[model samples]
Target: MRRPSLPAWAWVALAAHALFVADARAAARFDAATRVFRLDGERVTYAFGINEAGQLQSLHWGGRLADGDPLGPAKSLPSHSSFDLSASITPQEFPAQGGGVFTEVALKVAYADGNRDTVLRYVSHTLERDAVTVRLRDIALPLEVSLRYTIDPGTGVIGRSARIENLGRTPLRIDQAASAAYTLAPQDDYRLHHLSGRWAGEWSLQQRPVSEGASVLESRRGSTGQQNTPWFAIDRGGSSGEDSGPVWFGALAWSGSWRISIDKDPLGAVRVVGGYNPYDFAYRLAPGERLDTPVFYAGYSDGGMGGASRLLHRFERERILPGGGKPRLRPVLYNSWEATEFAVDEAGQMALAEKAARIGVERFVVDDGWFGARNSDKAGLGDWSVNRAKFPNGLKPLIDKVHGLGMEFGLWVEPEMVNPDSDLYRAHPDWVLNFPERPRTPARNQLVLNLARRDVRDHVLQVLDALVTDNDIQFLKWDYNRNWSEPGWPQLAPEDQPKVYVEYVRNLYWILGELRRKHPKLEIESCSGGGGRIDLGIMALTDQVWPSDNTDPFDRLSMQDGFSHAYAPAAMMAWVTDSPNWVNRRETSLDYRFLSSMQGALGIGANLNHWRDADFATAARMVAAYKQVRATVQQGDLYRLISPANGSPRSATLSVSPDRRQAVLFAFLHSQSKGMQEPAIRLRGLDPRQRYRIARLGGGALPEAMPAEASGAYWMEHGLAVPMRGDFQASGFVFEAK
Candidate 1:
């Protein structure tokens, strides 16, 4: 049967109507009669309502309920005592500091007339397909706040944030402002898990019980410090495992100093407040000026910690990263830092580039000595001009050579820093961050530029824009080697000095965004003395990150395990460096180092000038093997079969493709005494009905007892064992489903 075709506009109208219907099904719902709002994801639901007092109150947040499930209207809780009023007892969605509320507040303001109290109440709201915005105003003053809620239907992750505006004629001072507050029902036992570490050691998982007091995780060092990360997970009564039980996790998307407070009140209710740190922080807003806080992303997972991480990973890959959430794969990079640290020259760089290309390196980076008089970190930081002495013919010759060798050229840059002895500082000493008549403290022989100033921000953008425009650069190893010693903005008034903390970071983000907009093909790696500035904020702007300065294979196993709890392996840039690692002076085999680095985005930082023929062959083989399985390793479901924490003697990890057609397993042994046999590792996230063929990687035979092929059910149930018999040994295998 043939039917008459409709007009183009009619077809478009029909398609639009179908889309509207689908969106309506997934959209947030607000009941005007009961003053209740509900947001539903695939497997999770979040509900809240307005109380009689006009304050927004939390209702339920957990597993999804049936469409007709009844959620009663919001009501204020009774006061426990005179000190704890009803306002404090009730779980306010966004609590202000006034109204007898003693808990961590979402907003704190000081009016011009010496009033510091603020009580916010619901005024109105607007809803979209997957988002909702609610407006609240102070009961007396002309201060307004807007709360935003966005949900991802596929992963059941919700994003929350708030915006503050001043409607009065006079200026208002904001002392404390948080993005969102999440409340959890009382449980028998609540356990908190977070990540913490230092310079040579980062991403160490720490667990503790949630007591009646506040447990604060913060970064006070301008950038996201290594001392703590802005990610957390809470499990009820320690009932959750790697892949089972209930867990709630969240991360704040801010690269500047931030805070997350987990407070378990005396009445047994647990509340989490996260946002910009109030320490040495104040923002003054005049009439009509507004400030928007960073988004706080969170989710619920009945499948446990592993499930929580997997959901977060998928959300980040599809929503947070660049390229409209579909970021490109990280290339195999070779950096010349270890080989020619401060002695970089055109000839030396080209020679290293040739060697790198021979081993399948797709990008060649010249680190730390191509510009100014940068013989060492002590000088030549702010000077962005090419060093005529090192590169007599300029960077074009070296870049052309690298391109001819079939690799992209990259360079290291630190635009946010300047050496006191550099030409730029000598020209404009007032450009760096400093206070009047106060001695400027320098870290790593450099001072942080006052990016808060428009002049300084423009200078940085111009320099970087010219660098990429003049050269055929494809990637940048953006490095920030030190923290802020004294953050100040002398150009602004005394009352506005505290705004540096917020403006500095905003300007940094602006510069990065502008650079990407100008050069669409360029990619960047965010490095702040190694894992010091990695967060959802920076990850959204950069392609990958350097996890740590300590490349010791053994230490990396533990670091990688902890890192996987919050971040995707696709953004982790692991480098295979020298043995007898500079950090620990621990010697490990080259193969072990390769295996460790293969778990993430692979990069080689070894000094090829010192390698033997056997080393080259080994590296070439490992690089090829990594190329074959990188998609699964970088963008697949990671299963931690054996954890390497607490100095465990053995560790193993498995990566299964999203389609379940392939899997890769990497196992390591620290030391085996008395021939103690390790247990077989059970596989996960595989299709039970399909058959898979086992294949060995890095040229080794499979176990004699293992079969060549088997059903996924048999492999997952019975497991497989790989032979390991020495100290610092590693092996890997691939399973191809047929």
Candidate 2:
């Protein structure tokens, strides 16, 4: 009963040591003898093996299992006549739509011999560190398929893709091919969660119960449309809260048209499949030709939706995004789109640049109207050359002014779209996507360029290259403002018309890659009228994405929540625009707007000229505060404490730095009730024994009668109260280990 007590510092050190060990154990691992793949990041396991019939069967996918415990005890085959109708009654690793198995199929191939039958049998497998490839072949035909699975041990994100080769004598057509098919063990109740919206209102999260039949979400607009996002999560109806329960989730890494199907079979078997949209899609594989599907990533989380999101965030930082290494802290930008849209001139831009720099902006972007007959959205799009009338001395004068003002310069251009009124379209009408005899349909008065064509692709690259070289451009806002209509290439043979979808994306990637090679320091943002093309495919090449055309901060709350479900905050470009907001005309406080936009890569899209001296001061101060927490907010694990969709009066997000020493909280109270008390929010992802100092950042009062410092354990257990009393009020705080 008489042991020497350790000092406070010693105790803190011991706690930090234990925290490191716990975090280290979260990495994923695979057991060969047990045939169990443990995704320890979420404490989940996936066990699978080939049955005696040489078919890959999914055995287990859920919470971690003991090393020697068998997953999914063997069940005898049914004596009823339904045995033939079911595919062995076991979860299939990759099921085809044939053979009387009525569940969702992952692949459908059409052969030249007028047969569409496919019966795959496991042939061989190769396993490497953190990756595996399982080969399968047709039981009768000469078709070969291989399933590739790669896992990022740190994040427990399993990436799955398929490779199909035409080993037969004739060509084969891939009528329907999914990147991956995931099946979860039967649960009492399943709820499917996804995002759906249109235009100014995009990425609105919606959750519905999984029913007996099938529910589908897809984009057939030839691009990742604003109508639907290609990501989903299924909870067992156990917990609806953001930070609780078991949830399974996946997202397709495709920027083009895609489809995701959630099917609940008769036996209550739930399966999710996703890949390229097969509608108007037919990939012809010639003899010896092989097609590789995009990667589909899936993960399991016992800590619920928030856990799944943080896993994806870490995976994107460590494994997905590339910028010489991990993506750097995104610069705080000031874009002039809202200020001088289509009215951009050297003098006006220079004046705006000075104001932006005065407000502590790190980047200044000149949006639209700087190029080719472009006084309006209807005129110059594809013409990348500067408009002499607007930029009389070229973009050089404005760019130099921005550089001298201590900010990098960026320009906006829709390289993939051409206005019918533009010089480029007038000279090369056939270069646009159109059938020989069909009328060309235009959106935004612009035609989609046939990037699938060699000439068109080359022209886009040349124009962009010259712009960058001549103007010393450090950044380009590459936009795709319209969807594909009359998608056809008459220059190609009739049989090869479908190649437009495949080749267009390929050529875009090539152009981006080539430009990157030439200008090593150049940065680009991928925009499709905003949030139209935000997907992992485009994310690989671009620095960030404009989530939506609506910069109303309140709307962005839900939009960003949905966007971050499958994407990292670093890739979600959120802007702070003027109030009496553009779309909703809902007036919000400047601090509220700043805090909302600060949740992601922060940028200012407000018309600086309309701002008063106080507004400028607030903007400058908030930008400085953002800089202090930029790295942590962009790269840390995100914990959504309160959901905006729940119609709550308040919403909060907490970001914990990689190290357990720092955390930042951005809390907003949309509207306060007459006698409502502020909620006490619990903090996560911290060393419990370590004490932290809580300090306010912007214009917000601290909790009433609360201490400025407390232990992490106390913060998590008892929590800290957020102040209340106002409509559209927001606050930010930082917690540092004391």
Candidate 3:
């Protein structure tokens, strides 16, 4: 990987003053007696705060009630609220503020009517040399929403960005968001706009592969609600536009605010910023850090996903690429289903790993069958240990074999669920989560682990900790297969069972947090029976998620599109030719298969040993081309090239790396009609100034182009020749911009 040079403007700021030009504005009050931050708005009063480190606090929404409204006398939904609050720092984490200048910040919400409400939030603060941990113990009212503001390390401006977690019992469900009045004391222009593009590259875990898969695709229908993706740049009391600058104010929680801001950059570009990277380095909030005082930033992006990235880098210009480096992973790799699946003998397992390594892969992840009991997916899940029957030689040797092949080894673990037939379940029935005297239910041949139990938590910690300490596992695909529909925590009292939901989630966080801390090099991925639990809430914990189990290229066209609404292409686990098309009725060609997977994390989920020589040759080229322009795909502004075809030759393209340096364009052609002409689709998200080298996988002519505009492609005025053709399934093209 190569390092990117800092912008020349940033170099100038490096030599400029960093603290003397600090500005402070006081509008809301932080109250010590009440322990809540209060922000007064034109229509309502916003008062709220959090103290729970890994736990949750409460939110109260009240204002002058109308006579006709029922909320005041009897109960109604308009003016009442009780939200469970969480921290960047887990609440239960015993924090010791080796005392200094640490301050606390939070969000406050109030209801005015059914269609109106008021919101007040704080921003994440910047990091300084004299920084130390300070857990937010309590939040009393009138304690003006503020943090110990520090001068930006690179730009000298006082900056703060934080995340407010809504860990309530039921999802609060945000409809339309409106800002009351805000204190516009800092900048003369209170201009707020919609931002576009990628985010600043300064976050602790800004995994490019994950970010690319984590986009929030626009919603046309209402089956799946819109994703609460946080953006930077929106002024309270001003008209919203498409321009951006610095996001210096506002204190809002993450789930509660989908309407973030877009600030003005020196240029007219609607630059985006935020997401807790400004104030701290990329260290897991472990041993020495405070627990409860955590936060996340939501910005405003007009260019949708593209806008968000632009706003992110605006404020975080200096540390965009921490070491200012180039990205390597393009979310492309191969994963085996059995490294942790039903018991498989060491010889059989080694064969699979060996084959995967030989298939032009950077990561060879062993999935489920490698750990626990006898052969079959029905046995050991939470056991987290090697079953001698399958791997007599132990995991270290297997990992060593993978390492010797020069490929990264990844393992699987369902830390939050277990199988009743395992040792952990047999010895401790209490560890199994179920209703009293109720028949046990099953999903994926496994039972849910009662994470709320202290003993159960201890067992999980022990198992995971050892997995990391024992083998040379570089990545752990942590999976949670079900939702918390049946609220049952055996250990908690009947009355306290309601509290179990929050507790279980907290314990899970604790376990993951501890693991990341103990093993900083550990790469964690969270998968929930495939996209079952995809949301911003989980992104804070894991890097990427398995978008779905249906790896069929045809089915993925819609599934992946649906997932893009709230996630990026980087977070989606796309496999190249996994088994057969799980949906529809046809064998998808490998070229189409590779093109299908190219849109997201590229991986091979099928038996690599079954691949033909031609397949190997094609796979090698795709991987090489992928590495060449992954940064453009993962971090550059994204644009949809072709409209989705219901059943005809469906095709689309994503032009990644738009600064004109390098770009990757992918297109997939589905179905070949007897008398139809092959579609030639024009590309999107490209720079007209930079010429690109276009190539095909098997063999085809390169796509020609006309002209483009800042808004979008002008050539498509109509579509072009399809990127690929065959079983009418999938195919991709590589367009490298230089």
Best by TM-score: 1
Q: Please, what are the lDDT tens digits per residue for candidate 3 over residues 1-738?
A: 964688776644443322212311222333322233333322222233333221112222223122222211111112111231221111111111111101111222221222212222232222234221122222321111223322222222222332222332222212121221122223334433221221110001111111111122221111011222242233322332222322322222222112332323222222222222111111111112221222332323334333444434332323221122332244456776623335456676678777766656877787777777746667777777787766777887888888898887887778877777887778877777678888787766777777778888888888888878988888888876654434476665554454453356567767877887888767777665555444444555566667666676766765665444334555567877544544445576666677677666677877666777877777777676666656655556456555453454665756566465555556655666675656556655555555555555435554455222222233223434553334555555555443
Error of 3 at 173 (Å): 21
Q: Model 1, 247-339: lDDT tens per residue?
A: 989999998899999988668888999999999889999899999999999899998888888888888888888868777888999999989
Candidate 2 residue-wise lDDT, 404-439, digit = tens: 999998988889999999898899999998988888
Model 2, global lDDT: 0.82
Error of 2 at 473 (Å): 1.7
- Compare candidates 1 and 2 on lDDT and give the better one: 1
RMSD of each: 5.4, 8.6, 14.7
What is candidate 1's CA lDDT for residue 245? 85
lDDT of 2 at 7: 80
Whole-model lDDT per candidate:
0.90, 0.82, 0.47
Best by lDDT, which number? 1
Candidate 2: regions farther than 4 A off? 1-42, 66-84, 699-704
Write down the worst ten-residue block by lDDT for model 1.
15-24
Task: Report RMSD for candidate 1.
Answer: 5.4
